[model samples]
Structure formats: structure tokens, C-alpha cells
Target: MRKLAALTTLALFGLSGAALAQEVTLRAVTSFAEKTTYSRGFERFIERVNETGKGIIRINYIGGPKAMPPFEVGNALKNGVVDIANVTGAFYTNVMPEADAWKLRQVPMAEVRKNGGFDYMAAIYAQKMNAIFLANFVGDNPFHLYLNKKITGPDMAGLKLRITPVYRDFFQAQGATVVQTAPGEVYTALERGVVDGYGWPITGIFDLGWHEKTKYRVDPGFYTAEVSALVNKTTWDKLTPQQKAILQKAGEEAEKEGVAEFAKLNAEDTEKQAKAGIEAIKFDAANTKLFLDKAYEAGWAGIIRQSPEHGPKLRGFFSKAN
Candidate 1:
């Protein structure tokens, strides 16, 4: 009788252990194509998570923007259509307006993580978008204006520029006519003269073939470029504590690694740009200051206008205190 009782207890314990060992799989998508430099950070994060997470959790990475439109990734997350998304804050600003502050961040993400800004931003994502604001995977690069026509300075009067939310206000502040479009449409926009130029980071022009039509890159780029990891709040809440820790740890490591790697890629892309016959249109010191001033003022003003409550707090956390 004692032996039979012990055997029954052991059998129940074995079933419980099997249940605990069942792996969690998460579906993920990126905003850019897989090979593009913009998606490299998310790729690395997925790699780290798969390797370290082991049977605890595994990310089932869906294809990049090909799987779903970039603008729709946020909605997919909100509506529980996917478990995770490797998207940019700019891409999801429709869900959380204060997200634009991320592109305007003046400090390193590591610093932001330490100074309570990271948690604050995470809270905003949860409350506003039903998502978790994971670590920023790309932030070391800055956005520059790539133009088909050479401009003497920052006076953008009468020029039509392709704009993303990342620089819409800045371009408007510089007096350019802004034309918002998807990344895939930029080539047609450029080829057909729908736009004379577009705002983009240092490394992605060639990937998008914008370098083929682009003639000049204006120097003294205004604001930083950033892409982040965003997890669906429902998915995040459902994760086991161990799985959550693994994902969080992988994000921190990937963020640090990505920032360093992308910086090197930025340097290489600069040479590639020059080799591709794209010239630089550098602004003089006075014009540089005027240009930067206009960019930031317009950027923050737009943020404040859109998000009356969270805008100033975001500025305080991300910018140097006055």
C-alpha cells in the first residue's frame, strides 16, 4: 500500500514538471526589412532571447514589414494580433503621442534607464497603448536630410521633403513642404518628383536604394534616430516570471550591444555614401545653431501640443535639467 501511494504521488509530480517545462512561443515582427541595418538590433535581440531563453521561452519571429505594414504593427500589438513587435516609437506615436520624445532624447539609453525615465516611458506605453516599452535598441544614429538638389544651407523654402513623424515638425519649422509617405513609397516619390528629399538615418539610404537618386546629405543632422522593442501588455503580463526576466535581460544586453554595433555601421555607411557619389552639404557654425534650434523647438512644441500632461515630464527626464 505504501509503495502504491508513493508511486501515485511521483506520477502527479512528473505531470506538474512537464507542465512547467512547456515552452512559451511569442510571435514577433519588425518595422523594417530583415537585412536592413535598421532591423539589425531587433534581429540580435531575438537571437539572444532564443539562445538564452531555451525551453523557457522562444520567440517565433515573423518576417519584417512584409508580414504586416509598419504603421499597423502597433495596432496589431494593441488588438492582441501579435505577441511582440520590434517597432519604433515613431511608428506607434498614433497610440502614444509622447513617443516622439524618444527620437528627441539627448542622453544615452543607459542613462535614461538609470534615471527613472525608462520606467516612466514604460508606464506610458502600458497606459496609453497596452504595450510594454522595452529597451531602445537603436539610438546612437542621427537623422539627416538627403536631397536630390543641392542646398546652400538649411533654408528649406519651396522644397518638398518626404517626412516621417520623426522629423515632420522639424521640416515644417525649416519651411519645407512636407510629404508624408511609407518607406516603400519613397523611391517612387523621389523618382517622380513627388519629393525633392527625405529625412532618414545615416545607414538606411543605401538599403532603401534612396542613395541611387539622392545627390546630397545635409550635415549637422538635427535629432537622434531610435527604434525600440515593444511587447504587448497582455503578452507581457502572461509571461512567467522567469520568462519575463530572460526577455528583460536579453533586451538590456542587446541594447548595449546594438548601440555600439550601429555606431560602427554608421561610420561605414558614411564612406559608402561618399563612394556612391552622394555629397555632403555642411552648414556653417551660425547656420548649424540656427538649424538645430529650429528643429528642437518645433519638435518639443509639437510634443507639448499633442501631449499636454506628459510632454514636459518627458523633456525633463530625457534632456539635461535647466
Candidate 2:
């Protein structure tokens, strides 16, 4: 009868709607410009996860800083205004002070993940930042001082340096008048002589056109650049077990492969920097030891000073990692 046909049609349409509802698309943002190495690397992670997650889950990268400024992205994720984000620890230190340890710690990513380091960080993020620490994508390349003036030693006295939480203590210890500046503002600060130099990842100076202003790379780079991908805890909690497993697998794979990708790019960029006339201050044996020792001491001490209760326990992992 016509009534039976109508009922059947409604049932079919309802089933179709249900099927569409089964697919999930998470909105993600990053703390970098779209053309930068960080974005390039993170997009690859999104691609791989989307490919692996096909029907169940999809990540739509909404955009980078244009969508949400770098410093504000973490708060967006925490409040569920964003489902995911690729953010740096420096941006979220206010949300989770212990996050500074992620950038300052000397342990390699492999060891960090293998030992309890990543899980410890995940717990911290979950409890304090309202996010899940998915994985670290850009940690292979370390940070270096990109300066307009050349210096022979670690004595940064009287220089106005742009700093992030990662290098603030170490640079301050070296006597530099550290100015806290956001990544996007560094260029204007440099051009206006608001800052004499800045610290950045070994591979990304060219991305921001900073190479044009940089004349010297103070060698013996310090601290692994820890750019982490995070998922909003509310969103994470709502995922099906299978979707969670897929995301976890994708994050692990991205972390493993991203290391090699960054390594290759770092070498290429270092060469490009040399050709572009950026001088390197080569460290001799004694200077190399002195520089690393002082840098580590300054970094670890700062972390402990900020979060005494958790700091020593976390730093224990670094010693074990060695």
C-alpha cells in the first residue's frame, strides 16, 4: 500500500542519516603559519591519520594562526572551541606550567616515549590543560641562536634577545636582557632593534624570512624543539574505542617518521643558511662542554624553580634516559 511505501522510505532515509552521523570530522588548528615547516610536517600527520581513519574519523585542519593566534590556540583546545591543535609548550606554559619541561628536558623523543616521559606529560596535560597529549612531532631539530651580530662565547651580556620559555632561563643566565616576544612579532622586533637576536629551531629561520636578518648562528644548539599535537580532552573522551586506537596509532607513526623528515630538512636548511651567508660560531672541545653543561644546568634549574614538587621527579627521567 502507499502507507507501507512511505514508512519504508522514511526508514531508509533515517538509516542514511545514521550512517552519516557515524563519521566524525575533528577541527584542528596549528601554532604556525601555513607555509612554515611546522605546518608542512603537521599536515602530513593529518594526511596519514585521515588516510588510516578513512570512514570513522577525519581531521579537517581549519587553518593555522589565521584561524587562531599561536598563543591562544591552547586555550581554544582546552575549552573545546577547537577539537585539536599543534602547539608549542611555550604557548601553553600558563595553562600547564610543567609543560616548560617538555622543551627543556634533554631526553630524546624515542626515550621519552619509551620510558614514562610521554605518559607523564599526557597526565599533566589532561589534569592541568584539559587536553590529551597526542604526540610530539617536531623534536629532532634543536634550537639555535640566530643573531645579527657574531659572538665568540656564551656571554650574551647587554644584548636584547627575544626569548621563549624554552630558552629564557638559559639566555638569562648568560646575561642577555631577554625580551619575551611571540614568534609572529619577532621580525618587527628585530627590524626595529627591539631585540638583538632570537632563538629558533635550526630549520625554520627561512620560513619567517628571519634568515634575511640573521648573520650568525651561535653554535652548540640547545634543547629539542618540542612541538606537540594535542586533542581536546572533551573530544577525546567522546571518541569510540576504535577511533581512539586509530588516532593513537597514527600519532605514534607520525612521531617515528617525523623525526627522519625533520632531520633531512634540518640538514638541507643548515646548508641553505650557510649559502645565505649566516656564519657559524664553531665550538671547540672545551667550549662545547662548557656551553652544554651551562645550558643544561640553567634549563633544569629553571624548571625546578618553577615547579619544585614535580620538577625533580621529571628531571629524574632525564637522568634515567642517559
Stretches off by above 4 angstroms in model 2 are 1-21, 320-322
Q: Tens digits of per-residue lDDT for model 2 on 1-322?
A: 9988866976877666446448789999999988688877678888988998888899999998887888888789889998989888888877887887776666677897778877887888888888998878875788898888777787888888999888889999989999887788998998888888998988888888887888889888877777778999999999989889988888888788777888898899989999999999887888888888888889889888888888887887755344
lDDT of 1 by residue, 263-292 (tens): 888899999999999999998999999888
lDDT of 2 at 191: 83
Sequence-dependent TM-score of model 1? 0.94
Root-mean-square deviation per candidate? 3.1, 3.7
Error of 2 at 264 (Å): 1.4
Which clashing pairs does model 2 show? Answer: none
